[model samples]
Target: MQTHLARAAASVDTRAAIPEPFADDALVTQPQLKRLTGDVSDMTIWRWRRAGIIPEPTSIRGRNYWRAGDVRELLARLAGGAQ
Candidate 1:
């Protein structure tokens, strides 16, 4: 029972980290990316990008931005198994 409860809490926490009503075509900036990804460090994002776990960001004016659609896909793939 405790294990189940812990698992449920963990799932909820992960979901809470991601903002709701994710617009498919929206371009998420660095800060928003962090929020969507459970406030992961910049290094983690770089690593994921390098590892091909995530698609490369669209650089604009020397800033990084990721498509919401891509992020949604990633979240679906990662959390699908747990849920």
Candidate 2:
């Protein structure tokens, strides 16, 4: 019974089994940002960008990326860390 349970657990597709491509402090693309931000919608990020709520992303060879640390800092500040 234990062997069968272990086999079933091994076969289960666990999302956490996949390794993240970047470190927490690394620059990340939009898709990575979505994952980091717990799947927040792209439209929300776009609106935040337009409203200057978040720091502007940097472009590299036509691709946009943001520093994970910067995003976290912004979120922390907005959560009233300054107060």
Q: Which candidate's lDDT is highest?
A: 1
Which sections of candidate 2 miss by over 4 Å?
Answer: 1-25, 78-83
lDDT of 2 by residue, 1-83 (tens): 22322332344332332235546568768776555444556776676677666678998998879986675555444333231
Clashing pairs in 1: none
**Model 2, position 12: C-alpha lDDT score:** 33
* Tens digit of per-residue lDDT, candidate 1, span 51-70: 77779999999999988888
- Assess each prediction's global lDDT (C-alpha) against the native: 0.66, 0.56
Following a full C-alpha superposition, what root-mean-square deviation does model 2 have from the true structure? 13.1
Window of ten residues with lowest summed lDDT in model 1: 1-10
For model 1 the local lDDT of residue 44 reads 69
